[model samples]
Target: MDTNHNKGDKSFKIPGDWIEQSKQLKEKFSTLTDHDLKFEEGKEKEMLERIGNRLRKNREEVLNIIKEINLS
Candidate 1:
């Protein structure tokens, strides 16, 4: 998997194809709304934060979930 590390953190950049993953996330977590998964070109962090908040998870957990979806 191609990943970009965040400064001073183990957090990897959200995949460029996050929109597809976001769809899977919504299917997995029905609580997530379209607005919650909305993606912008340079707003990856914001998107992840929004998803994490909705799922009551941390950023790393959110990233892991996305990665898992990609693997499937």
Candidate 2:
């Protein structure tokens, strides 16, 4: 029986060193500033989709890493 409250949440609890890893991940993705990013003249939609996909993947990766640490 699982008694964890955050089990279903995509958000992971940061455990010691994993906290640092999460911070690094956030810093890495923070480079994509709206003002600094440019899309091709006709590729606005495609660019948005690509950014969304990357964000989702990155989030999952961070969560997984946190989970591993929590389990250990």
1-72 in candidate 1: lDDT tens per residue? 967676545435666577788788889999999988888767777888898999999988988888899998
Task: Report model 2's TM-score to 2 decimal places.
Answer: 0.29
| Model 1 TM-score relative to the real fold | 0.76
Cα-based lDDT for every prediction: 0.82, 0.48
Writing each residue's lDDT as its tens digit, candidate 2 over 1-72 gives 978886644332334563354445446677444432234555534544454565654545645544664555
> What is candidate 1's CA lDDT for residue 33?
95
Worst ten in a row by lDDT for model 2 = 31-40
- Check candidate 2 and list the clashing pairs: none
In angstroms, give how far residue 56 of model 2 lies from its true place.
1.0
lDDT of 2 at 15: 44
Residue 53 of model 2: what lDDT? 61
Query: Model 1: residues >4 Å from true position, as ranges?
Result: 1-13
Q: Each model's TM-score, in the order given?
A: 0.76, 0.29
